[model samples]
Target: MSLVDSLKDIHLSILPQDPVKIDTFVFRLHYFWTVSFILVFSVLLSLSQYAGDPIDCIHDHNIPDDTFDRFCWVEGTWTRKLGFDAIGGQMDKAFLRKDLNFVRCFDESTNSDGKPHEDCWQHQYYQWVALVLVLQAGCFYFPRYLWQIWEQGKIQSLVSGLDRTSLIKGLQSKNELQKGEIKDKIQLMIQYWREAKGTNNLWAIKFYICELLCVLNVVAQFYFTNFFLNGQFAQVARQGLNLDENDSILPILAECRLTTYGSGGQPQLTSGLCVLPLNIVNQKFYSLYWYWLSALLVVSILALTLRILQITSHDMKKFVIVYFYRIKEFNDVILKRSNHGDWFLLIRLMDNMNDVVSSLFLDELEKIKPFEAYRADE
Candidate 1:
């Protein structure tokens, strides 16, 4: 016996007398739930922005900010910032035509001068947009809530139904039972456990995707906040410049009796228009929205991490047991077998493992706080 043999002996000494593999059906269900979350959330976060006015939906919060090419088109890869004074392409023509056609039609119907019609169009457009934004936001949230409820129930069912110890004991007793009976019982149990393990992994993957989307949202939000701010400020500055161009500082200065100092006595300013409307709305809404979005992103990230930890922890435990057991089993029952076709030892080891795991199932699962509460309450 060399180092390998010595190590194998050490491993066998530490191995549990009985070790259980995760239930396959439970694992598969977990994976399904996770995959469902990924599909649902990915669609919600990525596509909701397009739910509203296709032109302005790019600005909607329904879509996760992190997604690229969904917003105003850029030549390179996806980016958050709505860059360019105008979307420089034929698309701009389409937008301008659409804007002008609607505005002109409204102006004609109202039969009013340019200013009032513009104001009316602005009000109507913004109000319609606000409604659309709200509806788009709903598309993402409603499905997720419903799925969470459904998953909660299914997880409970899985926890309650699994009886691996009984399953293993039944399999062990098959030595005296009919060959067909034994095969059926053992195969069914193995199939179920295998599926359960797959489900767990699937869920873990979905949680990971959710976390990634959350990170992307944070980045997107940051860019959108800046984009909205700059546009608002630029609009204000343009108005200010127009007002200054119209008014002469010399006259105001003379009226206020400050002309005695110099020719450039005062700077022109727009009275009662200290703030731009959109700028104010942007400042107020974005700050509050940012806080809320950040909180949501953090929650999602934490949920994903917790899910991954749960799935991985179970896997790690199973691996540790299998790794050690395979070595010991190879040296003992496997090597001593007269016929290579006699896999009885392997079958017995698997059954024993299931028995051990089934015995401790609830106790180990309860360590997961979310499930613990649910189990206790249920």
Candidate 2:
């Protein structure tokens, strides 16, 4: 069958009748649902910004109408002659400035032409940041997908059967015939457990692989995000803050100016600049990245530690039970009963058998043994 079909079947089969009893820690710790929510939020934020123009040119307000019109006409004609767009059309073509030098805003006293304009650099970078957030969310969820694909099916099957058997055994207590059937089922379960023990190492390896992926995903996010932000104006913000690369936090908003050198080697004001338009969105997103990613890292570490502890504890318990059974068999005294009473007790203890099933099996064994003893006495 196709993977999608198998996943659908697994999801349908694992739905618990009593939802309260279902353990959701695995789902939550896997981080798929949480990351998916973040992805959706980022997509919506991007769409909202897309509905309006993110960048617009800020024209110089100090210019007089007649002089400004003549100046614009001359500049526009020259720009068109040079194969550049008209001044009005230039407003729509605002791209991120690639240089490190800041622009100067127009000063009416120092400059003759009031030609300075500003474009929204923030708008351009914010879109990229939004895309990065989506990618980060996918990284958070990929490990969970790996687990579901590799291990979740086997885990769900085992847990489902255990739950079903426990429920049935609980309900069958008053009926002798049903109790006998449960006894047979318990024996089959014990045999399955014995066979499953041989593959315990294989299961442990699979579990560890998923655990490692979870850790690696968090580490990759930390470095990848730092690289992405630094590559896109984060370094410029750091320089503005007078902080080194290591000490600076990612800035959501910054202002810069674009200047051109005049013939006299004086800096002429060309444009006033505002970088990163969606400041609120970026601020919230980065704040969440700092807090949420840190918390997730801690939680993932703790979850992995707990899983390792659980596996160790389970292995120790199994070893102790098996050692005791071996010792009992070596002594041969447990074999004196000759009616499999001791064998049943050992199996029940070693396999972590249900108390009800153990009691029913012991009671039936007692009844049969006493009848055989009476017959021998006669």
Candidate 3:
């Protein structure tokens, strides 16, 4: 299927599991789902490197074609620097800045002594593209590992066996053992929360920090990819538009030299222009990659900021119960007496329960609110 269809499947499959997840959807998008896409693309790109000819060359009469192609693909390729004098007409292009086109090649850079200027080797990165992408996948996956290490499944443990009890459905399917176990878990959570006070905020704060890291990671990937492409990646969209003989940017034909032995064991150096079909593919692939990353950065930043906004709501815990369970008439004392961590925990617990249990959970908090408030007054 198409790439969009492939991405759609990944997106949908992860959407339903968000509620069950201990972390946010943004976290899954970076470490899990995005990693899957990059690795798959890396594998597909690697096939062309091994199974197909990465470069083709037309050599001198004596130098064999296969030998030249293999030599250039392995050794390296070079691009010439074109000064503004050569770019006389097309100076309007953004890529033609003085920093860009350098070292015109062996022919143009020859001095009065008949020597070429400093050789600028390019396209070595093309050979290692697959490995580089794998490294990038690792970058995205690291934060998840860090968060998991710190988390140690704390949220999961706190709300353990929440779904197994009859609280979700009706009293008919009730198992007293599970019911009591669920109650004990909730009771322990409540007691721990009441005692812990502001201490529990660390759990939620750690999660938020990881979410922010995902956004920062996206920004870093842009620079890394551009550097890998020899500064061509960021300008691909612009340089790509004018793909002419003089303005060859993404898949520019590169010059390669191969030295072989002749009859008297004389070393003969031959040069040829090698065609890199891989760069053609890279230009398009990374164009899509760039756009997708740009969009991901925007979404991730917004999601993180909006989440923080939700948490800052004055009546966040109370609002959760009222919005989900429509419980308009309930004791608001629990909210008045609750600490940041208590609100953080209660809302998270309620997130996993159904409306019936959520209202019941609200009621349990309501029963405690008055006594907690009364004790605080004393």
- Per-model TM-score, in order, reads 0.28, 0.49, 0.71
Best-matching candidate per lDDT: 3
TM-score of 3: 0.71
Weakest lDDT window of 10 consecutive positions for candidate 2: 75-84
Please provide, for model 2 over 1-378, each residue's C-alpha lDDT reduced to its tens digit, 9 standing for 90 to 100: 975575556444533133222122543554644575566556556765577543333446443434433332223211101111356544222222322222232445654564433321122244466677767777766765665565545434333333444544645452543445555654554454444533545544554676678777877776776665544333333333332221112322223333456689986553333333344455455545655666777887876776555344544333433463332112122223322222322342323334443344334443444334644655
Worst 10 residues of 3 by lDDT: 94-103
Write out the backbone clash pairs for model 3: 80-103, 81-102, 81-103, 81-104
For residue 251, give model 1's deviation from the true position in Å. 28
Model 3 residue 333 lDDT score: 70
Higher-lDDT candidate of 2 and 3: 3
lDDT of candidate 3 over 170-220, digit per residue (tens): 543224323566667666766665566667778777777888889999999
lDDT of candidates 1 onward, in order? 0.32, 0.44, 0.66
Candidate number with the higher TM-score (1 or 3): 3
Lowest lDDT 10-mer window, candidate 1?
250-259
